[model samples]
Target: MLKRAFLPPADALVAFEAAARHESFTRAAEELHLTQGAVSKQIRHLEQRLGVALFSRVRQRVLLTDAGRLYLHEVRGALDHLHDATRQVMSFAGSQDVLNLAVLPTFGTRWLAPRLADFLRQTPQAALNISIRLRPFDFELEPFDGAIHHGDPIWAGGIVEPLFPEETIVVCSRPFRDRHLLAGPADLLRVPRLQLATRPMAWRDWFEAKGLVTDTAFQGPRFEQFGMIAEAAAHHLGVAIMPVFFVEDELASGRLVKLFDGTVEERSAYHFVYPENRALRPVVSAFRRWLTAEARSARLSRESLLPG
Candidate 1:
């Protein structure tokens, strides 16, 4: 048999959190619809359990002790998480499952957002809640069923499923390309080259792929996101290396033009990642199958578009 965990009573925790927030037992009691004495009793019980004085009682007011302040921060976070989890469950009404996902900002907007309608249509029983997360995080701490990951497949304790490899190409404003007379990769050296801060070696790799070695690969105005870099390049700031999937709108609308005929495939790829424990979940499995199929179709379409 499993040993019982040492946890304070839920009602006491709730009372303590409320009391700590307002720093007044009367105010907390009013908010919780309890008498001031009842709120004080709950807090007193909590203090006894923890073996620490939570508040410093002055003439007629109460202030959090250092320990109380620290505990309040943690308790508040736990309460907020619990509230959110409860709300999420309640919101699921009749849905079979709700998949909470963490997605990269740009990827979420450009790629995943566009395809979500299809997923919704295909899996009518499931609902999705997406939040932007720039980097990988511990699944145990975060309230997420899965995450869309880019780069290496190195999420510890996660089941990483490859979505697609990223293919990037050189792009610039029409005038920027024409003004510089960039007929080949070497011509790019004369013009300003924009850089994505995340991929420092992108230009270097592209140049090396074309049999050219230069010190200028790392030189340029760096932006944190590809969207910013693409916008800068569109305004003739400089040529930017961007994923083909991201700049379809710009390329189609004539705002940005590809400078080269070929693309540089990154060593990394996009992945659908979830904790190993979720592998057997029906919702997770359904979404994975849908996503991987979509990825495969996208890859085939891209391949067909490439020059043979």
Candidate 2:
């Protein structure tokens, strides 16, 4: 067990953080609305508590020692977390529970945001705070109650509920398609191919699904987000392999055209993930139920659209 005695005072931590950030006790004191001597005293006390020299006093200037630099990184994170917790508690209203969620950027904008009105309608007492997180993070460190996770169900210390599988298809601007005279999957090889940085093997997988192989399957300008790839493809930059759900607007508006009839199923699917201890929370349970039903409906709708 960690000893409370090992912990420095919160005020001291704040003083240390401000001083380290500005490299000036006077600046830190000004920010904290305290005297320079008081800020210096707090830093000295903190250094004594931790048994380390945090800063070196130079002629009319202060510089962080090696230990101070390392401690600053951890201190900032702790202070930010404390601030978030304090804000959350202060914002609590009668009979209303706050649910913090992290979601992938493109997925959150296209899929989740559109359906959130329904969730809010169903749970009038629930308040949502959503943030974007592209990859998996520790639930303990982050303030989120749950996250919309893609790729796999491998979040440690969290319960993973399957949502829906991703179906990817090749798309390009209608003009590009007509200009290139694309008739089959093989014709895509002659044109520029845009790649998703996160899914480096997307194009390679698409070709493999069609029983084709090529050395240049991985070539193209790479983008970090699906939205970027879609935009680039829509402007006739290059052909892109996009998730069908994400490009529905583009396809419907004829901004981008599907190159073929078939869709490639990615190896991983989306999932609703939360810490195991939160499983019984009413807000969590309600959200999981709503999200599961929405995913099921979407799946059925998608399946109905597929040609037999």
Candidate 3:
């Protein structure tokens, strides 16, 4: 009977928990990094196997009455117990808990990956699962311990800690900048602007911040990501408003040069966001401390250069 009880795949239970917590599969999907269809299917499969309906759907929203609430109560406890047991067993081999991180793709690849060697050295035997998240996701609904997010936007239900602040500066290939005879800021008007779809208004914001609100901000070909935009700029296809932190190597190598003498803060800063409820987790707390230390160190260096 016990074996039969535990026979069902753990994924079904996970799906149910996620759905019950968020009351919206879409949000759960974002958190779990699973498709909406997949989440719903998992829940449905679990319900069929258990022979009990878990969620009561109403008008495109799910409501948890007695059954779901009770089930969640028990399931949460069970899951916690299971996790504890797993950790206890795995702890013997030092293959215990994992720290799952979801970060912006470009930032993770260009910045975080390099630092991971040091991180691993410090936290020996700790496994790190770094996943790329190009958009905002539901941390509560997902299994991520934490995430590195872009933008200076406020986090409503999660903890938002700054990893760094950034400024968007106009950059283009050296040859392109010179061949176009781009003498300064005003010269940008005659060049092609490479835009990031996520921040379609980045050019506008930067221009406005620099007191150059021209119609050109809205007239660029949009790319889905910063990496693509950067690549196009590296190839001298056009001028790109790129975050300085992301293109440091290119700039240092003189492959990509700042087009203007000035830059702008689109009010967008990078943050380390996670469930506020997760602060109690030891791994979460440790990573936060370590990350903040790095961020503060960098901030201090940047501040040292300022006329403050």
Candidate 4:
């Protein structure tokens, strides 16, 4: 005996999901390489089988009904889980480790990219897939295996491995610094300070740490990402407070200069975060070992550069 109540025809469900996602039978048909009539028929059959209207037609636009919206959420999760399970089984059969990792944009570009070659060389049996993500996402719905989070390890359902604390230094174009005398931290208040939207209080924190205060610390042109701020600072638009490792290339080429003599430690630090359940995977363990070691090595290097 088979349980008909528990199983929907996979083909019909796929067609329904695609149509619901696009909200247009024509678009879904094009995506699935089927005729519009066939797509419509599948949705009609699915609605009938479920004993409800999945969608409502208002003129030419198709909108999901309340029931349809709820069903779509569950359907998407099931589909994603099935796909992940299939891939996991394939990886296991082949004895290969596949990791879907998300990274912060600027850190991925300036810091991790240069070191990934070594990671690949040391972990040849593993295949690392990288994607750019700035914030935490749901592991139950999202496909990411882990992420490099640039903040405190406070995310629920994840185990955090501390990488390194972030230390920022103020930097500006050399030409801009040459034109103005910035002999002390107080002089920084006179110039236009570029700011990061993510770190709204960066300048305030840095200034207060140096025993100075200013009203204009929060006043500046704001950028959404670190890379944009770096580019703006390099062009002499304004000064920026950024991680030393992030602006190393600009400093080496003489395009940018550090404005102060001391570094400010930020409250948040970089960390490698993964789901607690997946911590035992061989691939996860390998990456944890390699990246933790790399972060430790980098900390030593950063400490040596700062004045004793």
The per-model lDDT (C-alpha) reads 0.87, 0.90, 0.79, 0.86
Give me the runs in candidate 1 sitting further than 4 Å from their true place: 1-90, 303-308
lDDT tens digits by residue: candidate 3, 1-308? 88888566888788788888889988888889999999999988877887888888998888786877888998889899899667644644655557878988888877778777876677676777776788788876677778898876666678888877786678889899889999866777788889788877777766676578697687877888778888899998999988766777788777788765555655668899988888788778878888888777765664333221
Q: How badly does each model clash, as a count of residue pairs? A: 0, 0, 0, 0
Clashes of 3: 0
In model 3, the clashing pairs are none
Pairwise lDDT winner, candidates 1 and 3 = 1
Query: Tens-digit lDDT track for model 1 on 27-54?
Result: 9999999999999999998999899999
For model 4, residues 1-308, the per-residue Cα lDDT tens digits are 37867677888888878988888888999999999999898889889889999999888768999999999999989888888777655664544788888899999998888998998798888886677888988777767778999887887788889998898888989888887787778888899899999889888988898899788899999999889999999998999999978988887777788886778778889999999889999889988999999989987887555432
The true-versus-predicted C-alpha distance at residue 67 of model 1, in Å, is: 11
Candidate 3: where are CA atoms >4 Å away? 1-94, 302-308
lDDT, candidate 2, 1-308, per-residue tens: 37876889999999999998888999999999999999999999999988999999998789999999999999999999899778777766664788889999999988899999999999999988888999999998887889999987899989999998888888999999999999998998899999999989888878887888899999999999999999999999999988888988787788988887777788899999999888888999999999999999988887544432
What's the TM-score of each model vs. the native? 0.72, 0.82, 0.66, 0.73
Ranking by TM-score: 2, 4, 1, 3
lDDT, residue 111, candidate 2: 88
Candidate 4 lDDT trough over 10 residues, lowest sum: 87-96
Q: Candidate 4: lDDT of 156?
A: 79
**Leading candidate by TM-score:** 2
